[model samples]
Target: MAARTVSFGIGFRVGGSLSLLALLAACSEPLDLDMRGLMNGGFNTADAARASTAPRPAADNRGVISYPNYQVAVARRGDTLAALAARVGLPADELARYNGVQSGDTLRAGEIIALPRRVSEPSPATGATTTGPIRPSSQIDITTLANDAIERSAPTPAAQRPTPQVGTEPIRHQVERGETAFTISRLYNVSVRSLSEWNSLDSNFSVREGQYLLIPVVTQAPAPREVAPIEPGRGSPTPQPPSASQPLPTETPAAAAATTQAATAAAAAAPPVANVGTQTAASASNAAMAFPVQGSIIREYSKGRNDGIDIAASVGTTVKAAASGQVAAITRNTDGINILVIRHPDNLLTVYTHVDNITVAKGDAVSRGQSIAKVADFEPARVHFEVRKGFDSVDPMTYLR
Candidate 1:
């Protein structure tokens, strides 16, 4: 192939210079070079050389300044979108839509203000990795710019992640050969009635082989109130008017203690509610499941009484298991000829149906992102996930988090 050559206008203009500066900042992008270079030839050679030497982006690998065309950054604490737009030569409304923020909203520092016709970014994965090109408002000074725009003193993401709530503690008890639920209840100083309810088993107390159970010590719940019929001549007492300062009665110390204990036990015995996602053991595959794709959640789960939920994804997109699990059942429904089912360690089942091809076999264990299948049928295919306990379908949204 002949050597490629570029052309530029001899007389450079100021408008072309700033845009060229942005292009030079994002020289890695081919389209950026062609577009910005057309306007860049007139820039002062000295200034262009100076900018090339001092380049250090604070956002680990996020080169916000590289894509200068569409963005202006928040410089200091409390800078409004209007003010930032004035500096970057864009409308305040444009900035608002870029960051999904409002015009009157206060920016912290180092935020990007996406301007029109900004430089494009190379796909770094397969193409060039220009920092400046094609950045949106969300990617401005994208590193520190986005973070600093709110507060230099803002909490680090790890700090911002909500603290894990204190979930139910694992209760433990050894199984005695001859002991029944009655015997264990007496030994633990807990009521048999409470024990049956704590465990999801029937009240028959049919103890099984060598299973260790967690005994939750719960207080006896008060009997529900009942309405009694009165004789024809009897009358009910009149209700008293409410008074803000009136005090409430205090339960006896013994009753109060019992209530507290029962509450603690009940809390300990409860199971985590059903969710769209399921928890799994620590593994590389389990962690990889947090991201379904690079796009969005176009469809949702359980809109009706359906077996599973669907996630609309691009056709031919790679499908992954929700978490690490044993391959439970693989079936080709009459309608959906291509289907895959994985049973995670947590007993959660994720089904990838309507697939173009199945890469896994029935009973073949798979991992998250293991490329078990692909969406071959339509423009965007869906992966149907159904989490179950035994055969009971549970809501999956609760666990996706």
Candidate 2:
């Protein structure tokens, strides 16, 4: 009887252990995070499921959703366009018109309402990445030029105008997670060896996250100055007649002879400025394209990293077309930022991003310098401009006047 009892107890214990293990196995079945959409970019059953979810960025305290290319606000349950606009500090009618909805129309929860313009940037309080472009401290703020010009009515002479020159010092960069020495060097288009020497990196050239390193300096030659040649007769200044305010002297033989001699002497002397041409050159060159907006270039183009240049302007500044072309496409990125592409001759294309209030539609004919849109209201208020020849992007400065 004792042996039988011991056997029964062991069997019970084994059975209980098996039940527990089964429970654990059931609980450990892979969690359905619904992350398949992110893992695949192509359309499939997962994409349809993800679309129903309508995942969107969470709004901050200001009710603004911030993205690199654009921003949006999510609608709450039982909310109207007007209510959402008020919560986000935007005009109700403007918001409604931009989204193609009535002010009083009810919105579905989690529905995205694209912002016509940027409201604010992600704050540090939210723990969002607030990294900006790395620039040398010696770089001058370009807005100063506009401010100085506004303060004075007369245009400053080119010779007297202060030209902002880039300094030779290395730019300081804070290493972010996943950044390597080689990547940093590639970002600034400098050799890794120079970057290591400037920052005094160890033999391994390892950089830790949150560590600050100086970017290597690159010696760049000054661009050739474009001087509009003076035409042969155009350079000569025309003499003005005596003003009516001044009375002419009485006619006298001696005074007339003196005036004649003085006039002859002046004519014999070289003109204060020479007119080297009858008309300015109308021939087009590589630099025939006009700037999309009048602002300082905050960031220059890098082939892979930055495919275009960033020009910082006011929020409502007019953005003009770079060249005469037909509007090939007007679309939005994943972030809903407006992108305008114009198809020019020679199979070239010009792209304008971070702009709002688009005045032209797709397939519309646009002329050079035509107002196509306005700069978006971003924190820095900048426009991303690019010039593309076929599939590759080239230096915008090479073609910008």
Candidate 3:
């Protein structure tokens, strides 16, 4: 009876262990929860199946968006002004100017670039139109756009008139040994006319050593003008000729003879005017000519070949007018280099090329040695200067002092 009880106990323990293992195996299986149907309301097999099969939109690589008025471009990594301009079909310089950035500057990744909605407005002076990728107006700062428009539309001041300013005082400078009016004007960064006017001296007056001269400070205030008093209800009457009764005042015979002799001597001492042909032949013979820029000549003019001389100069160097003249043309070349052509007395035209940041415009009257433009970056970094008589080019060295 005891042996039979032990066998039954071992069999019970083994069956219990097998039962526990089977329970654990059942618990390990996935629950297969109906999430979509439960969130909607209860378990609906059809709704859960539809939720799992729906399609979604793919991601975009351009990272750009289109709006009703304007489009925007998101800058990518390693982008430059030139690259952006080329991508958008706009000129690199124009693009830089529009964004108030330099053409050689780099653009930051993820930066917003403002583009024109439609075609850009044509430049009034050049009549050139811009074509490129468009940007929305909302992306650009309104104030910056307005300021740029104002600057482009504002009229340029006359070259002969100095820009006016208030509360300006005269600059006093003491004349040094061997300093002439030209040198003093240059030292003070002033025009010779301003120097003469401030000191009450004539244009031909010579500066003496140890003398103090007052240099006029340029101001925005317009110079005062003298207006004659008008008669009541009409302008001033023209002066009437003296009556015949007042015989023309006559000088003494001895004095008149001496004046006549002096006049004859003065006329004899003056140089004769050259004929048109002679003037053309000797066009490059002005002794008072000034150098446009202080630099060594890299390329000299050769007959039947090069028409101008190239002077080696550092970028951004100030370039002055070789002689006083009226600016006939201020334009850019195909490569966007600035060119200035001035028409001087005696039918002479001086050409300055490869320049940027020009100070004068067309029809401006510039003085000799006046700053006109700054040297621009070119392959060789030089200025091409030409002295021309109508269509004939001459050697600048023959005329430059």
Candidate 4:
């Protein structure tokens, strides 16, 4: 066969046209490619340089789709707070609070709305009322009984009763507008159970204006002694005596030396009271935490599978705070499961998820074993408990005694 050659870009050639693919393969060397440049829409040298130096958006591993800021969500057409909350499995109130909008407020389409990373599951309806915690007879409908009691106890003539002294005896309180039994109980520093028992009223009974009810006189409990707030993983510093700029009195050299020697001896003999107290406090804080809900652990903590331990429990089981701490957040997962996060000392955080009802609000201070919520079924009727040190998840079993 006669030799034939073809010339193409830069030194490319093919001889004798064995096959177009084979000829090209023989002449072409493997070329190094700038994949990044090609992926950036084949940016030119200048554009590539600019892109390399441009600031990149921050990234997180939360596994949720977020906007550039990661804290705000862009509203789409016909997006209401409630609808959006439902779509994201958050409570409407939390979503509204994040956006600084009222729950009933209308939202403009294409508006930029701030969103909380998570939602809070709405507390469950208690008994026949949604106003307060579930009572013993909450499920019982005593409307007829309350009506009968009202009929039986008609208002007494003013002349027949002596006026009560302001602070001496139980006084008659006139029902105000927009007041419920729960609110009345709180105002009087009494319990709803006590109020219902005293007045023979049912949980569902409505209070009307101009109605007189006997307010029970309760002796207020003594206030708790204030303690320094404990931060996570840190101890309270011992207070030192104040120092004066100018020296006041001078003592004899011998007396001063004697005093110094005595102080040193005392300090050396005495145990480290402050450090002991701190360690004791830390130990107590750790010991105070109990399982939020008692159940068999169905799911163990795994790095990628689950962040917390799942305990299988029945619905309406009381969920207590694992430790003494201020409520950091009460949010919900994307599955519409309620989550309660409490910030405790030692940089520790306890999370209770799949809750049925919440009794404490955000920022409320709760003690260990305090009934803060109730557990309900999420996937298999379980409560999810997570112990975290700052942002890192830790095995709860390690710290949980």
What clash pairs does model 2 have?
230-276, 230-277, 231-275, 231-276, 231-277, 232-275, 232-276, 232-277, 235-275
Candidate 2 residue runs with Cα over 4 Å from true position = 1-286
Model 4 ranges off by over 4 Å: 1-288
After the best TM-score superposition of candidate 3, give how far the Cα of residue 123 lies from its true spot, in angstroms: 37
Model 2: per-residue Cα lDDT over 275-385, one tens digit each: 321221222556568888876677788764467788877899999988998886676654557777887899787888889999998778999889999999877888888
By the TM-score metric, which is better: model 1 or model 3?
3
Model 3 residue 269 distance off true place after TM-score fit, in angstroms: 49
Q: 197-308 in candidate 1: lDDT tens per residue?
A: 4443343654544433445533343344487978865786667888869677566688789999999999899985534333322234224243333334444554222445
TM-score of each: 0.27, 0.32, 0.30, 0.30
By lDDT, the best candidate is 2
List the global CA lDDT of all models.
0.47, 0.63, 0.57, 0.53
Q: What is the C-alpha RMSD of each candidate to the true structure, in Å?
A: 34.5, 30.2, 36.0, 29.0
Model 1 vs. true fold: TM? 0.27
Q: Using TM-score as the measure, what is the rank order of every candidate, best first?
A: 2, 4, 3, 1
Which residues of candidate 3, in runs, are more than 4 Å off?
1-286
- For model 4, name the residue pairs that clash: 119-332, 232-346, 232-347, 233-346, 233-347
